[model samples]
Target: MDIFADFTQRINVAVQTVLTHYEAGDVDLSRVTVEPPRDESHGDLATNAAMVLAKPLGAKPRDLATRIAAKLARDPDVATAEVAGPGFINLRLHPGYWLKHLAGLLAEGSDYGRGAPTGRKVNVEYVSANPTGPMHVGHTRGAVVGDAIANLMAFSGDEVTKEYYINDAGEQVSVLARSVFLRYREALGEDIGEIPAGLYPGDYLVPVGQQLAERYGAALRGMDEAEWLPIVRDAAIDGMMAMIRDDLTKLGVNQDVFFSERTLHADNGGRIAEAIEDLRARGFVYQGTLPPPKGQLPEDWEDREQTLLRSTEVGDDVDRPLVKSDGRYTYFAADVAYFRDKYERGFNEMVYVLGADHGGYVKRLEAVARAVSQGAAHLDVVLCQLVKLFRDGEPVTMSKRAGNFVTLSDVVDEVGRDAVRFMMLFRKSDAPLDFDFKKVTEQSKDNPVFYVQYAHARCQSVFRQAEGAGLALPDFRALDAGALDALTDEGELALIRKLAAFPRLVQSAARAKEPHRVPFFLYDLAQGFHAQYNRGRDLTHLRFVNPDEASISLARLALVKGVATVIASGLALVGVDAPDEMR
Candidate 1:
């Protein structure tokens, strides 16, 4: 249970009672929050109820705080409700309260941190890297962030769909098809010579070319460019997508939907055309000439009339063009159709996980969401910053198979999936990340993933040690408040306090669309567990497995189980494993 949330309600009641006693008018209590004291020495939980409500009620904060603390002090659960500073209420719960909650934590087990279900359907579209090649290192962070966000939302009780947008209808795939054709000729005993400047030079496509040669033989080569382009394009897109899916699987990202852009342009651009007509009907579409872009010279700007969206009416800085001068739909038009399709599919909340370079697309996409949903839906875009790889402080070299950039598989294969995922989320998505090869592989506390995983391994080792010592293990399911009667140490209570904060953390992280917070929480939790373990090493009374003293050992074992359960659950949300033993 979230003790902070429970106290938040109690604090609300205390504030209401004080207001009624004073006959003060109804005040907004929404701003009042109950959280742990930044410094644990202050108290267990702290609230700013009096400070938030004092000014509106025309009273001194400290005076109001005394009244609220008096009311809260009457509750049995609150051992002390002291007025701190100007108006904050610092609460310290009775030891009995934590013992009861520890029993509850053991009972809840894996479900301890799960949130109440909200009937909201969310669509998280991410890692929609073009299907022209394998996923590069540039795409790895977004993929990991997006996947973890989806997992986090699901764990927090929102029905989420993980999606990938395939840019198959774009010109890049056509270039891919041509590139593969060159390799196919090379596979068929032709000297294709050096790869042309505009074509992809990656040897990763060689297998696709060889497969095409094996499947179609000389049939494709005899046809005209138009006739063979579609066939080769289909084969190449299929091959590249297969490779992309494999790489995502290696990184543990399982997308539920792979929406193709080709679907948006099928039937003479029917979906895009329909989306434009819908906007026109809503009076958001217009015919106009955009002024020369701010950074572009007048002569470089096109002066022709064009079909455009009145995106500025929503929130975009400038109007967006829907149809280019060539009478074809622009990429932005495809994005519009895609948004419309998702909106039609009953998704009220859409999240886009794009690269940091796509910051310019944020306002336009929000404008599209506002216009297409008619202000009924919510849209969020999370832009992930670049990741620079290193090897012992030196910049890593590129992959020969990928021609220039490093592939996702390269990083995963070197450091393993858990290290890649945990490190990717170790920092905020918008902040730059520097990933080093050697450091992540180390097993010390300097490696956050290892530190966290080792905590779990240590917990298991405690139980194994008990078994080896012939001490009967406590039944976790049968544990209750009475079973924890011997846990009076301040250190033990502090650990319980940290475990009690998990539900609140999950709710806050999911609401904010920030999965990085999970790893941060796990790291701190591990540190606490490690510190407690070291304390046990110094003081025999705090040890978890005592062959002679069965009561305290069982109590400490229960605490160990609680730690392991939470660490495992948090790791699952982060898409990492909580191993029982570390190699």
Candidate 2:
């Protein structure tokens, strides 16, 4: 149950009662919120009912707060309600309420934080790396962020579709095809030395070259460039995409759809042309001339008139080109078609998980949504900042396998999947991250992944110890509230409060599109569990399993089990494993 939501309703009722008593009618109550107090010592919960309503009612803030507090003081669950500062009402809940909630949590088990259905179809497209080579560290953050957001949304009741847009129609993949051709010639014993400067120089293409040689051999060597380019291009894209898929699989990311950009360019750009025509029918497309870019000479500008989209009228910084003077559709036109395709597929929200460098694309993408959907759909772009890799405080830059950058596979292979996924989300997606190989693998509290996983393992360890001591837990399915009454310690109550906040946390994080909050909450919960465990060590009476006191032992064991279940549920949402034992 979402206690915050429950209290919000309770507090709103109190506000309505106060307003009616004062003959104040028809005031908007949406701004009133009940949340945890900023300072734990203040109270268990706090509300701003008076602060939001006093102005509308033309009453002093403190007077409204006193009335609201007095009304809330009558609640059986509220142990104390006091006005704080100018208008906030702080509440302390009775200990019995927490104990009963703990029992309910233990009953819910793995589904504790699962949300009700929202009925909104959300398409989260991320890691649309060019299909030219294996994924590098730059793409790793975007991949993890997207996957975690999708998982979070799915957990929080939205119907989420994970997708990848393959950049197969770009010039980079053409260079990749040519690079593979060079490797093919070399594999066939031709002295094709020194890869050209403009082509890819990575050694990963050697296998593709060998495969091409094994299939076509001398036949491709004699064919015209036009005849052989398509064959090699298709082969190279397939090879690279296979490698990319393997890398993603290793990192625990599996997309539900892999949309090919080449499809939009098929039949001589039919899809893009159709999208432009649709926009034209909506009066968003026009023939226009773009002014020369600032700080550039007029001679350096493409000053010719061209087919354009009136994107600025919608939301973009400026009107964007749709078709070039040469009659080819611009890249933005393809983006428009892609968005229309998603909108037609019934996605009410399209979330783009792009790299930080794609900041300029945000406004135009939003414009596309506004123009194409006519405000019927929403577009959100999350920009993930770059990850700087370090080893023992020193920068480690080069990767021999990827030729120029560290591949995502290399990072995963070095530190394992759990560490990579957890660390990628340890910080907000927009903030720069410094990932240290030595630090993440360290088995200490400073390492968040290790700390959280160890907390789960410790909970398991507690159960194992209980089993060895011949203390059979009471049937948790039939567990009673009386058993949980033994948990009256401040530390135990604090942990329960943290655990109770998960459902609300999931809803907020999912709505904000911030998957990093999951890891943050998990870390805090782990810290609380660890602290409570230490408390038990110093005080024998507070231990989880006491042979002499079966009642209290059963209660504490159930609490430990609840902690483990919540941690496991959270880790699974982020695609991280919570091990039963950590050695």
Candidate 3:
């Protein structure tokens, strides 16, 4: 049961009673919002109903809060309601209410914070890195964010599909083919000079060349470019995809669907053309010459009329080109067709995770999806900022030419998947992150991953200590309502209240499409657990493992276990492991 919801209902009923007495004509009740105050001393919950309606009704906010509090007092759930600090009503729930909520958490187990399903199918497409190279740190952030969002949505009752859009057919892949072919020639004992300026210089591709030579031998030595490009391109794309898949696996990410860009116009089928025609029929496509870009233009920039999408009509900064002047479909065109295909497949809601460099592309992509779907489909694009690597306060420079770039596999190898996932999600996706290798691996309270995991381990430690002391733990079936009352300490009650807020947190985070909130909530809850544990260190009487009484110990153990369960559940949603042992 959501105590916040229950309390909100009580307050709403109280406000209605006051409204009936005052006869305030036609006040908007929808404006009333009950929320936990920023400062805990303000109360369990504070509402702005009185302040919001005061000016409309020609009544003072304080007077309204006084009347509302009196009406709220009739409810047994509310022990006391008082107005404090700038017309805010602070509510103190009865102690029994929190204790009973703790029981519900233990009974619910891992399902404690799960919410009802929204029944909307959401397609979360992320880490759609080009299939020409291995994923790097930037791609890892997107992977973690998308994966966490999928997990959070599923937990909150939404149908979520984790997808990866593979850009397997593009000019970049063609470049990859040429690069691999060079490697293949090198494997055939040819003395190729220094790797060209535009070609890939990573040693990772050297093996791809060797493998191709091993498979085809010298038969492809004199083959024409057209004859060998396809064979080499397919091999290179497959090999790169394999490496990317392995890197993602190391980071604990697996895509449910790997959509290929090549499929958009493969064989005789032309979905891209069809999508363009559909838009053209809707008057969204036209032949237009784009004004020269505001900033510096390349010397090769040529002013030409090209087919464009009227994206500005929907909210884009400028109408975007659908086809380049060279008479080839632009990347934007392919993206529009891909989104159309997604909508046709019955996913009305879509999320795209992109790097910060693609910030300018967001508005146009959203506009295209809006126009093509006729506003039926909604698109949310989350842009992840850059991650600066630091080791002992020194910046770690990664150069592509020097072949010194840190791959995703490199980070995973240094610090296990758990540390990488947790650290990546410990901040807002839009904010720049500083990843310190030494700091993340450290086992201390400063390390958020360790701090949260330590709370879980400590809970298990309490259970072990109690069991070793020959204490008879109460049977789950036999524990009565009164047994829970033994947990009467203020800190213990506060921890229970925090646990009770889990479902609401999940609901809000899911609705906002902000999965970073989960890690923040876990950190707050861990702080509570740590505070209570540290308090026991000073007050031996508050300890969970009391030698004097077994019943009290059993009740306290159950409470600790409840904390552990919620922590584990929250960690699972973020794909972070909850360890029973910290080491």
Candidate 4:
């Protein structure tokens, strides 16, 4: 069903035949590659077998190209083979091949671009926001990117685990507990003045404070820090986690596993401490003094011996600390234990989606996974850049301290979930994105979300128009390949070529671990659909509902339906809804 693969196989056979006839010194068949020409006018597919083998064979590329072309000329799949611009074999496929592609699309439908399963287990950890506050715009980008990547991998036939790592045991959570306690005191009518500089001042936590007062009453009012810290910390953590889960649900992201950082060290059982000890047993951990950090040294910096990981051996910038001077495990230590747990669970591939600010930390983390797994597991970290919010061409300022930060709920409320998901994925994850409130909502071709969705809606409109003309639409199962040959228009062929490339596109994007390519491919596919639609405006005969000719109308309808099927399948992968009607 893959015309490109079919043609490549044909060319490889031809090349081997030519080599055998010439008795050319052993040619490496594995070196043969077939690809589409960068310039479309060149051909449907091109190969450089002749050019690649020419120098070693002591022959001119042009002469070798002629021999290869003559051998390939006999292939039924190849309509014509000619050498163009310095020994490039330009190949034009038979019209029947393209027609077969349309039929294949109809046959496969939603499963057309699915790939063979690798059967390897992969764990993708993303949107592991600290359970201290509601998710903001920054976390939203990571959520969408991570979720789309997991979806893409799953579609590509890999077993994927979607996970969220909760930082509930960290110092940040302690700060959150104190902040909530201040809110609790405020709820009890205590005059806690001028919300301290580093404490959370958002009104969202007021409810958490009030709920604590209602539950505990005056029992916690006169208790020392030790007596009430745990009580308040647990409540605040639970409240924050609930708020975060709600924000994720609003954006259509649901985690398969919620991993608690505290669980690694629960019951003073010290599983994390045990993990570090195991690493030390493997020579990955040792007591060492680190070199002073470059650029700027902290005013309180002091030279001291601390437990460090042998990260430099695995390619980190420098050895990393595993314990702070206060004799507590560093954040990196907890991360190592968490990844070890992932390995124990039988995942050989792990992907971490982090904010752009964590770019400097990528090498050391990858090194840790490498050392801990002893090169058995592969870890890839995708750093998503910050999103700058704009409204009417001006920057949107958000300050959590000033209680002015825009929550994820606010954005979802302003624009529906479909627009939010599509726009977030319209750009590469590593590239800084500008989210314009006014522009995305506008109904215009300039808005890519609307444009792609409109293509889907237009396809449905064609079906409705065909019904109005009193013509029965062709069943995809009943469509004849020969009848599709009537769609010989240049634009129609161009769209079909794009459709034929979908499986290859999916494989390439999945192999590269880049889900952004899906949106880019969708945009190009939408452009093809739009161009074909606009073509009908000029030539009424090309329109889908030509009442005078049922046969021609049915063929065109089949083509548009193919376009709609692809749009729906692609949008579904990225978690965007494909609408049948756009108002």
Candidate 5:
């Protein structure tokens, strides 16, 4: 049940009534906002309708607040409604009303917070890591973050497409081909020396080379660079992609699309030339000399004519180059085509989850979306900060036995997928996170994932305890129709109030495109459950299994079910498991 939404609507109705009373029909109710009070003791909710409507209606804030208060105080659902300092109206919902809200939660179960279709198609692109090797820990955060965002948007009724842009057409994949060739020679018993500076050094490619030998043997060894290069390059890209997909599967990130960069250069209706010509026809492309870049200029920097995009007209800091002196398309040129393709695919919004180091590219890509879609589409970039790994307060590095960087597989193997996924989103996306090996697995309140999971498990335990006592949960129709007057305790009201905030949390997090809020909200909900459970320890009547308070125990059991169901729903959004037991 969205208690906040209901109250917000009520407040909106009251504001509209006041506006009509004043004959100020032009006043917009959209400006009025309803929110939870900063301090719970003040009230369950607070509204800024009075302050928002005062100037528009030509009335003082206090005077409008007094009027709004009189209207809301008369609501049977509201136990008290008072005008607070200045113009805020604090509202305390009746205890019986909160109990009914708990019954609503019990009735909804898994379907709670799921939204109806909004008819908007959203594309969330993340983890566009180079297909050069296994994914390292750096890519893990983006993978989890992007996947969670897609999940959240999907749950919130948007048609979401999860995408991964494979960087297979670049010089990096060529290096990977050469590196895998080294391993190929090694597999054939040739003494290939140390991996050179520009080639990939990870041992993960050793398998690719071995596979190449099994497929082609020494036949391609006699061929020149041109002939064997493509063969080996294709093999390397496919092999590396396989390894990357395996790692992503370990973290439960299965993207709906893996867009290949090579396709943009080769097929799919356009290479760089076609897309550039299209932009030129639209007057976004021009041949001119760009001013020198800010800060230190490159050694090759010179005042020379080149093909450039007039991206600055939209929002970019400077007009970007589309073609180089050597007559090849720049990276930005390819991106214009990529974003244009996504726009044509019917996406209204494009979300790019990139590393913080790519901050400079954000404006250029945004300009590309605007230019390509003619201002009909929006592009949002989420820059994920770096993650530092630690084990027992000491920095964790590459595995000694594996002889590779600390890949995503290594972390997932050590900590399991749930901890990895949860801790990755435990902090804000732009904030640097320290993934502590020792702390995440500890069974203590300090570990948020553990704490939240335990709360879910505790809820399950309550159900089992009740079941063992021959108590069965009533059907939803009965639960929905039953009165919960026995649940009048302060703790019971607090728990119900927190449960009422679930739909609000989901809506806000989905709107902000911040999936981290789900985990954060789950932590608070878990803490509330624990607090309520701890309260029952000293007061036998407060316990869920109280023999002397059967009706109250049954009502609290419904609350327990609400906690478990909501926790599961939230963990599903974050791609983490909500365990029935801690172990």
Candidate 6:
């Protein structure tokens, strides 16, 4: 249960009662909010009710605050509701109020932080790296962020699909095919030295070429370019895709769908043409000339009439061209078809995780979503910023390996997956991140994953000590009704308040589509638990293992178990593990 939410409702009831007592008027409850005080010394919570409602009622904020505080003080749940600066109200909830709900944590266990159902089907498309090469560090960030968002939404009861768009139809893969063909020739005893420019030079292609040589020795070489292109391309794509999927598996990211861009080409059922025709029938497509692009114009820029989609009608800055003057569909045409395909799959919400370089695609994709879904689905684009590798405050050399980039597998193999996943989400998706290889593995408070896991480990350590003290592992959920009331200390109450905020926090994070908030919350929670544990060192009575007082120790044990449950749940959401021991 969300104890804070219940308190907010109570505060609303008191405000309603105050309005009736003053014979004033009804105020919008939605405008009111109950949140933690900026300074813990002030009180447990603060509200802006009086300040928000005074303007509507044509009264001074201080006067409104005084009247509302009087009514709130009468509430059974509120121990004190003091009026602060500018009609701000500070509230101290009754200790008993939090005490009762502490049992909700033990009862719910890891299920404590789950959010209510959103009743929306969401499709999260991410890390759709081309099948031309392995995933890089940039792709890793997108992969982790996207996977976290999908897991969060799934936990919130949204039917979510994790998807990857294979860009095998592009020029990049054509180069890959050529590169693999070179390797295949080399495997067939040809002197293929010095890879040509504009072709992939990654050594990873050696194996793909070897496979081609073993499968059809000298057969592909005799065939014409067009005849052998598809065969060689398909083999290379399959091999690269297998490697990419293995890298993702190492990072614990799983995709429900791997959509292929090749399927939208004219030779592959002409989905792009069908999409363009559908748009033309809707009166949204036309032959039009786009003005020379702003700033530096392309050397080949010309005012030619071509097939264009009215992207501006939705929200894009300009209408987008669907086809080139050569009668070939542009990349945006394939994208439009892909968007329409996702919409037809019954998803009411779409999320695209793109790299920072692809920021401009946001508007065009949004425009496509609006056109295809007819505004029935909401599209959110998360642009992941770059991650620079560092080592102990010095820049770490991430020399570009195969395909002109450091593969994601290299980073995961270097630092464990936990550090990679947690550090990837340690900052907002759009913010720049410096991932330090040395610092991430250090067992220090600055290492957020370690700190958070250590808190859970401490909780387990307490249970182990309890077992040695003649107390068995008891069913904490079935503890006495008064189990939590034994936790009346100020530190205990503060921890309870934080635990009680889990459900609300999960819901807020899901609503904002931000999974970075999970790590922030976990780190803050770990600090709280660590501080509480350290306090026991100075105060013997506060210790979790007290032979003199079995009941108090057991009640505190339940709270400790609650902490572990929440840590595990939050870690699961972020695709990290919550270990029972730091060792």
lDDT of 3: 0.86
Order of quality (TM-score): 2, 1, 5, 6, 3, 4
Worst 10 residues of 4 by lDDT: 397-406
Worst 10 residues of 5 by lDDT: 474-483
What lDDT score goes with residue 250 in model 3? 90
Model 3 ranges off by over 4 Å: 22-28, 55-60, 267-269, 298-302, 397-402, 474-480
For 1-583, candidate 2 gives per-residue lDDT tens digits of: 8999999999988888888777986989899898989998999999999999999899999999999999999999999999999999999999888888888888888888888899999999999999899999989999999999999999989999999999999778788889999999988999988888999989999999999999997889999989999999999999999999999999999999999999999999899999999999989999979987678554423578789999999878889888888787788899999999999999999999999999989999999999999999999999999999999999987898788999999999999999999999999999999999999999999999999999999999998999899998666756767888889898898888899999999889889999999999999999999999998899988888898898889889888987898899999988899999998
Please write out the lDDT profile of model 3 over residues 500-530, one tens digit for every residue: 8899998888777788898889989999998
lDDT of each: 0.93, 0.92, 0.86, 0.86, 0.87, 0.87
Model 5 alpha-carbon drift over 4 Å, by segment: 267-269, 299-302, 400-404
Using lDDT as the measure, which candidate wins? 1
Check candidate 2 and list the clashing pairs: none
Residue 128 shift from truth in candidate 4, angstroms: 1.1
- Compose the digit string of candidate 4's lDDT tens values, residues 337-404: 99999999999999999999999889988998888899999999999999989998999878553286
What does the lDDT come to for candidate 1? 0.93
TM-score of each model, paired residue for residue: 0.98, 0.98, 0.95, 0.94, 0.97, 0.95
Per-model C-alpha RMSD: 1.5, 1.4, 2.2, 2.4, 1.6, 2.1
Candidate 1 residue-wise lDDT, 1-583, digit = tens: 8898899899999888888867787789999999888888888999999998998888899999999999999999999999988889999999999989989999988999787888889999999999888999889999999998998888888999999999999789999999999999889989999999999999999999999999989888898999999999999999999999999999999999999999999999999999999999999999888888876564424578888999999999999989876688888999999999999999989999999999999999999999999998899999999999999999999999999999999999999999999999999999999999999999899999999999999999999999999988877967989999989998888888888889899889888989999999999999999999999999988898898989888899999999999999999998999998999
How well does candidate 3 match the true structure, expressed as C-alpha RMSD? 2.2
Q: Write the per-residue lDDT of candidate 5 for residues 184-301, one digit (tens) a residue.
A: 9888889988888888777887888899999998987999989999999999999989999999999999999999999888853266778789889999999899889889997655
Q: Is candidate 1 or candidate 5 better by TM-score?
A: 1
In angstroms, the error of model 3 at 163 is 0.8
